[model samples]
Target: MSSIRAVLFDLDDTLWPIVPVIQRAEKLLYAWLKLHAAPVTERVTIESMRERRQQLMASDPVYQRDLRILRRTVLLEAFADAGLDTRLVDEAMEVFSKARNEVTPFADVLPALENLRSRVMLGSVSNGVADLDAIGIAHYFQASVAAHRIGCAKPDAAIFHAACDALGVAPAETLYVGDDPLLDVEGAQKAGLRAAWINRVEIGQDRVLPSHVTPDAVFGNLHQLEQWLKDNDPLTR
Candidate 1:
């Protein structure tokens, strides 16, 4: 086994449940639009906006990695459809971004990071647009790399390599922890990094990982991953 010297983490479902966060943010965004950009509400409902975003994402592969731009594009399109000023996209984005960053991480996340940092370099490899600084967990991470910043998302080796580069370590020297089997485990493996899947929601059978994409370990949460490292990994000891 390659001795782990660094740890990289996925942000969304790994640290916090992301669907609720996006739901709340989108709701707040529409409410904000109802107050300031009312015409958008008149022409666009939140559900329809989601469908439109999916359609846009299908048409533009770039948007799949760049959510900030995708959301802005959707806002512009919606405003244009309503014959309203396209300038409100920025303001609407701000509202959504603020809400998006209002995330409450898993209860075990802070403590696990604290424990792991004492033994190894810690970094964030996220595809989502969560601002660590705004989320008040920025101090825990030495390096933070995001897909939007890199113009590529997880399941792509380039973004993972970029993150390893940021931490001055070979991919094999880092253990990547995340929730998704494909994007996190498979991607990290492809990039030559060991992976641990944090299956907090326990979608065990439903998320049957392929034999080729099997993770190095399956953890119930960060705390379990942390404990397993201390108990088994030589570097952590």
Candidate 2:
């Protein structure tokens, strides 16, 4: 492992549990649509919208990386069918974006960031749209690379390389910490960066890790990760 000069993070599950945040955002978005776009509301519930989105994306996979465009396409199609104005699309997105960024990070996040950021450059690489700046943690990061903005997502080395390019570091000198085994650990490894899995998900007795995925290290939380970095201070290959 080369010395880590910069650290990149995955946004959603790695810092804050994302399921509830996204659910709440969707609910709020639907409510807003119902109020402002009654024609659309008459035909679609949140469930129906989700279904339509899946169907649309299934037929056209390019929107998978450009989620904002994907979502806008879904809304435009739905609105056209409902005889509503497609111009409201941006407003609807603003509603969803606001709710999406209303996240509370895990207890360990702020503290660990305060510790490590002064010592190393920090950046965010995420497939999600959550805005760390809106979430009030933007000060901690030097740059943010998102799938929608970068034209690719995790598991692709290009996105990781983009973050390293922004931070002026090589992949070998960067550390990526994330939660998902394949998207985070294996993705970082494939990108030629050291990876640390923040193993926060609780699993049942029968739960098992994917056998093919390997990580440079694993920690239960950012607190433990911080400690590991301290122990391996000036960490090197």
**Best candidate per lDDT, number?**
1
Q: How does model 2 score by TM-score? A: 0.92
**In candidate 2, residue 35 scores what lDDT?**
83
In model 2, which residue pairs have backbone atoms overlapping below 3 Å?
Answer: 1-237
Give one digit per residue, the lDDT tens place, for model 2 in 30-134: 888878898888887888878877887688756778777877887888789988778888899899888888998888899989988878899999987877778
TM-score of each: 0.95, 0.92
Give one digit per residue, the lDDT tens place, for model 1 in 38-104: 8889998999988988998899888889899888988998899888888878889999999999988
Cα-lDDT of candidate 2: 0.84
Model 1, position 19, has a per-residue lDDT of 85
